[model samples]
Target: MVREFKLPDVGEGLTEAEIVSWLVEPGDTVAEDQPVAEVETDKAVVEVPAPVNGTVKEILAEEGEMVPVGTVIITFDVEGEVPEPEAEAEPEAEPAEPDGKEAADGEPAEPKDVEATSGRVFAAPSARRLARELGVSIEAVDGSGPGGRVTEADVREAAETSAGEEATEEAAADADSGLKSATRKVTDDADEDEPSTDTDGAEAAGAASETVESADRERTLAAPSTRKLAEEKGVDLDAVPTEQTQDGEPFVTDDQVREYAEAQQQAQAADAEAVSGGAEAPAGGPDIEAGGEDERIPYRGIRKTIGKQMERSKYTAPHVTHHDDVDVTRLVETRGRLKEKAEARDTKLTYMPFVVKAIVAALKEYPVLNSQLDEDNEEIVLKGEYNIGVATATDAGLMVPVIKGADRKGMLDIADEMRDLIEKARDRSIAREEMQGGTFSITNFGAIGGEYATPIINYPETAILGLGAIKDRPRVVEREAQGASDGANGEAVSKEVVPRKVMTLSLSIDHRVIDGAEAAQFVNTVKEYLENPELLLLE
Candidate 1:
């Protein structure tokens, strides 16, 4: 039986994806649920997996091609069956090519088939890694698994088979050329559409800094899952060898990747043990190139979404910002005392946990700040539950991961959840639901060295609180003196300046939903709890 595999939704819900790389090609075997290609959506690069076990027969989509949803990208023949295409299998339109541009040497655009997914390589990450560690080329190993998938065992066997093998095909080619080895940059989506190098020195440097256009990527081939796994393990997938290939292109799996990384670490440790030299000089960072005027880069994905949401909020809400200072000396002391206890229970505690507790306490008394505006119905929706959104700045943009029912949780519980959510947001692994259903939001600029900021409301929500860095400043303290010169009865009252910890709080409110006085009172309540953190224990 012949099966046609269409590009399934990779959670973006977008209509199309740019085929980044094909994991398998015609004449190769594949198992059900195995990844066959890597595709780039608007915000992420994801893998397209096979739905059936079969031998690949033909591919409908080309690398660097933008394929629409439900379009058959690849076809396979199962169990000795001849393949046939159905009437609906016809492409609705031609797959869009990356922006047509000339190559570096004044040649026309490079061929789409260059290093294309025109062949098949199937191997686990571990197997590929093992081949690399044993000094074997992944493309040289023959797989034995179904669909010709390479396994760890296959890698071990290949190593044993080539224990004393001669120089590899790659090495032989290098020797035959007898030219100094060199590397060329493989273009990514961010690098594609860039005009070939035409200038020298600084002008050329500016072009490298900003991309003038965008196009498809033709870089290393690996499943999106494998790529993410490699990131989490601090391993470089490109450094791992693979035994599987499509038209001579290597594919990577997870296990071999981790194994290879571990081996490298062990080797580095051994080398360090054998050396008794002084510390090496720190490596210099990448050169910062000056920018060129009139360089315009397309703003899309999360950044575009953020812009739209921000515009809506700013235009729709009547914002009123209130600034105040908080003396959290007691809150700091209490947290420090309990931090060790929290770690013993396998929970990590941060100042945000205490801050959240204080905010929730204040919200219970002033429900208006915890409410949302229902514009269509023109009603104020007072939320009974307290789900607070914590704004975290990531490489992509700002992401708010909400902590659900925060009022019901303890300091430790809130701290742990916040830690996990922040990590997921920064890594772009957070889910849509995790960022929604917030009654109020908080942004801590203090973590990144800011003292205060006027935060814009997260639309529909009533308010947002921005925290500033905590610092020690001189504050007046009252004490009794032995002399009666400035006497209160028989004793003299004296004032002295002492260093005290302080933090600034900037609260932005939707004036339509909350009054200026109400907002001030709510913040005071928060301030009181933090100042007398012992009161928090009673709650």
Candidate 2:
């Protein structure tokens, strides 16, 4: 009996998810409750477990394809008697469009006859969609997938070949047109005795058309990472010169893009210098050509989610940032004293743990900083719990894993749990629940070497704190000392400038919820706790 498994709503009410990877193949036997695939939702990457024990039959959805909820993503061959309803429906479903392959008229095609299997072309649903979009006939595309199945790459290659052919025909037509025009010009100018002008015009027309044909003839080949690098550097992979080829096609690499970008910058600088020196510029300006085509990256999953959240936060809230510097000499000393003790207990100590403790302590005193504004009810909802979201930067994007009951956890405990959560977030193995239920957020840009930054408040949370790199700076301090000239019964106070470790903090708050004075006082309280690390012990 064959059992179909539909994708479930993983949580957060996400409408769709992209299949990141498959853990089981078509022939592999899977146990019940075992993870069969990893799917990336808007919140996090989660594993989808098998619903029943069965042999893998077919994968209906391809990796990186965003599938809607309740879509049948896979089918399995289970060892059981088929249910009566399913048994009746199985025959009907088999003849239906299992892969949703459609005709060019935007309608489902008729089911192919089983007897005509010899001429049938096997392709993934996504490949079929691409074929329809590119106006390429799927039957003409050679299969490169397992068991001679036609794949997306095969369809794309077919489309490119067709385009090259069309370009060649167009170029030939252009050459013929130029030849005819040149002939006409020569006949008209026969009495003028200047045939060289017509010849030059013909050659120029041919050169221009040839350049366009060459640009359209072939597409650049590059890995996704190389393409991403090129996009970041604002370099056109098609314009980048490369000596490497893969499968007889031009291949662009990261190093090649970087070198070309450097050369472009140099050329631009030379042009600027020539202009400044009143020198005549080159006829065509800089030699860099525009990109042939734009690269499209699917805007889905975590990246899209982040963009939406940022847009909402920026537009919905009027943000105000308060910046201040705190003397963290005592905080540094305290962490140094506890570092060995923490490592002794198999936990690595970092300044973040102390900062978390301090933030919690401050939030306890100024509850407004740890709250959400209920816009629907027009009320202020101050949260009683301290769930601190530590904003972590991952390769996929920024992820915030919350530390529940942060007020209850000790510094070392926060350190241990934070380390585990960060590791999980970075590897994309974190659960969606682990990233939820936050009362406040913290982003430590200091780790990457920034002094101060105005971080956006994580929506619903009234405020977010940004931490900067700690450095040694001169500060004035007053100390009690004996009289310099004569011995006195009472000690005299003296002021001296000394080097102290300090860190800058930027606190951004929603102005609608938190007043400027309140935000400033809240930061002052946090600074007090950090400046005197012993104060956190009382909390």
Q: How many backbone clashes does candidate 1 have?
A: 13
Clashes of each: 13, 0
Those runs of model 2 whose alpha carbons end farther than 4 Å from true positions after fitting are: 80-141, 150-297, 484-491
Estimate, for each residue in 384-441, the C-alpha lDDT of model 1 and write its tens digit: 9999999999887888999999988988889889999998888776777788899999
Tens digit of per-residue lDDT, candidate 2, span 1-539: 77889999997687667789999887688999999999998877899999988887667666755566787778788856443332233211122255888656464554453121236576655567767776666766787555677665566666556655554466456544434433433243445544343334434444433332112323576644566777777776778766556446786656566656654544444344333443344578878868876666656588988998888998998999999999999999989999999999999999998889888988887899999999999999999999999999998899999999998998889999999999999999998889888999999999888998889889989999999999999999878776642245455777789999999999999999999999889889889999988988887
TM-score of each: 0.57, 0.68
Candidate 2's TM-score reads 0.68
Model 2, residue 519: distance off in Å is 1.2
